[model samples]
Structure formats: structure tokens, C-alpha cells
Target: MLEIKNLHVELEEEDKKILKGVDLTVEPGKVHAIMGPNGSGKSTLSYVLSGRAGYEVTQGSAVMDGVDLLELEPEERAAAGLFLAFQYPVEIPGVGNMTFLRTAVNAQRKARGQDEMSAAEFLKVIRERAKSLKIDAEMLKRPVNVGFSGGEKKRNEILQMAMLEPRMCILDETDSGLDVDAMKLVADGVNALRDDGRGFLVITHYQRLLDHIKPDVVHIMADGRIVKSGGPELALEVEHNGYSDILSEVA
Candidate 1:
């Protein structure tokens, strides 16, 4: 469903290039895991894929279903059924969670020429998803991510993903700050979304999250490029021995 070829990206006004000739392909009904050490350009790839501003694409192209993704605006990307779950979710002080969620849903609906959901319908659907994610009803009434714990914020991100039902979903460090229980909750949410028509790119550092998600393919990235690609056993190898051996082979 998504293909990135020779992808090169660099930050604006900076001399250093972050991503260099990275290539990846994700098909529907499968999960792919990207594991890399610090400063490996994992997050940069995420920002670039999601169309976050200020990250200049120096070369290459990312295509989704025959469309050039880099050429579209951020909202345009989202409207095209792309969703990015951030590593650090920002808190909005004045916007209620429900209100923020409803606005996003309605905006996408409008872009797709669908009617805006009434408050009653929106509330009902959100309630169902929130319940499945273990989000309290009271929490939805508060400002977006305000005073939420790290796990709570991550769960909120997944909640948004479930509500949007994107065709391709990118989870950036989704298990970074969660406790074991919280991780299980988030993983369950992701597993529930696995279907024949959807794809997931799960970016994480540890094998623990991979234990829960069980990606169909595991890729090791280094120095701004994907150095090694393998099956689930590769993740287990990384878990036990780290990236030293794989780095040697790839180099």
C-alpha cells in the first residue's frame, strides 16, 4: 500500500542530511517494524512521511497507491488515508478531547465529500472506541492530552487512529513510555485494526513492543538507511544481541 524509494531528507537551514536513500515497502494486511538505535533518522522519516513542515525532501519519492505523497500538503496526506501517531503527543490547553477529535473527523469527512456527523452520532462512535482503548469517559471531557500521563497520551493517539481508520498508519514510538499493562492496551488496539485492506509501519526501539505486535517483517535501520531486512526472527536477534552483528553484515 505504501512504497518509499531512495528517500533522502534533511532539515531546513542545516548542513547535515538525516535520511539517505532509504527504501521500504509495506503491503496491506501486514505489519512492518523499523528498529534502529539513536540518531538513525527514524523519526525524521516519520516526519517526512507525514508531511511535517521544515523537513526538506532533498531527493527520492514516497508513493501511496500511485500518488506522490511528498507533493501533497499535510492535510491532503491525512485526507488520503494516512495517519501518524506521534512519539510525543502535544497537549492542547483549551480544547476538549472530544471536541478536538470531532473536528478532525469532520474535517476529513468534509474533504471526502461526506456529511459531518451529528454530535450524537460522533459521541456514540467515540464512546465505543474510547471504551475499547480503556479511556475513561471523564478523560474525554478534558482538554486534549492535558494532565494526561505518558501512557494515557499514547493511548489517546491510538484512539485517534481507530476513529480515523486510515489506510496506512504509522506508529512512532507508540510503546516508548508505556507500562506493561498500558502497552498491552495499545497493542490490543492496534491488533484490532489489522485487516486485509490496511497496513501498519510500527517504529520502535525495543523488541518488547514487537512481542506484542508481531510484525510480518522486521527492518534494521542505521546511519539514515535501512541496513538489514528480515522476518520476525530478526527482531529476536536484535533483542538478544543488539544491532552490532547486523550492522557489520550490512556494512
Candidate 2:
């Protein structure tokens, strides 16, 4: 459902390039994992796809289900079904988590020309979704991500993903700073969302996250481009031998 071709992105404030020609496709219902070291442009790829500002697309196209994501604004991209879970979720101290979520959901609906969900319906749906994700009602009443534990922040993100039900999900290091139990909880929430109508692109550094997420395809990225892609075994190879051997071979 997501296609990126020869995407080259650089910082808007300077001439330094971050992504140098990345091409990837995540077919509907499939899970794709991208593994790379720091500064390899993995997170940049996600940001570019999600239409984040501060990065100019110098070349290539990013299309989601035939819509050119690069041409749309960030909110437009969200309304068109794109979701990115950050490595470190930012805290919005003044806004209650529930209010932020409801506003987001209604905004997406409004942008799509659909009817907004009623308060009763939204509350019931969110309650059910939160319970499944092990999110407490009190947490929902608190300010978004403010004073939450690391695991709580991650789970809150998954909760957001569940509520939005985006067609294309790009998780950037969702496992970062998460404990084993918290990681599993987040993975289970992700797994629950798996279906033939959606796609997932999981960016992570460690194989442990892959153990739970079980990506259908594994890609190795270096120097702002995707250099290699294989089955899940590729992640195991990296875990066992590191990127040195693969980089050497590709070199």
C-alpha cells in the first residue's frame, strides 16, 4: 500500500543530504522491517513518508495507495491514512490524552468527508481499544505523555495507532526504551491490527523486536539507502554477525 522510489531527502536548513535514493514497497497486509545503524537514514525515511517539515525532497516519489504523499501536507497525509509512531513520543502537557485522540479521529474523518463520530460512540470505542492495550482510564484522563513511564508512553502510542486505524503504519523504533514486557504488549497490540487491508513498516535496531513483530521481509539500510533485502533470516544474520560482513559483501 506504500511505495517509495529513489527518495533523496536533505535538510532544508543546509545542503547536507540525509536520504540518498531509497526504494521500498510494502504490499497490502504484509509486514516489512528496516534495520540500520545510527545515521543510516532509517528514521529519516519514516519522517519523509509522513510528510514532516524541515526536510526537502530532492528527488523521487512517495505514494500511498496511489496518493502522492510527498505532495500533501502533513495533516493531509494523516487524513489519507499515514501514521508514524516516534522513538520518543513528545509530551503535550496541557491536552488530555483522550481529547487529543478524539480530535485527531474527528479531523481525519472530516478531511475524508465522513461523518464525525459522536461522543458516546467514540468513548465506547476508545474504552474497548484501551482495555485491549492495557491502558487505564486514568491514563487517558492525564495530559498526553506527560509524566508517563517509558513503557506507558510507548503503549500510549500503540493506543493511538489502534484508534486511528491508519492504512499504512510506519513505526520508527517503537521498541526503543521499552522493557521486555512493555515491548511484548506493544507488539501484541500491533499484531492485533494485522489484516489484509493494511500494511506495516517497522524500523528497529535490535533483533529482539523482530522476534515479536516477525516482519515478512527484512531490509538492511546504509548511507541513506536500502542496500539489501531478504526474508526474516536477514535480521538473524545481522544479529549474529553484525552489519560488517554484509556491508563488506555489498561494498
lDDT by residue (tens digit), candidate 1, 63-157: 99788999999998998999999999999999999999999999999999999999999999999999999999999999999999999999999
Give the alpha carbon lDDT tens digit for every residue of 1-251 in model 2.
Answer: 89999999999999999999999999999999999889999999998888778999999999999999998999999999999998889999999999999999999999999999999999999999999889999999999999999999999999999999999999999999999999999999999999999999999999899999989999999999999999999999999999989988997
Report the Cα lDDT for candidate 2: 0.95
Against the true structure, what is each candidate's TM-score? 0.99, 0.99
What is the C-alpha local distance difference test score of each model?
Answer: 0.94, 0.95
**On a 0 to 100 scale, what is the lDDT of residue 226 in model 2?**
95
Per-residue lDDT value at 141 in model 2: 99
Once fitted onto the true fold, the runs of candidate 1 whose alpha carbons sit more than 4 angstroms away are none
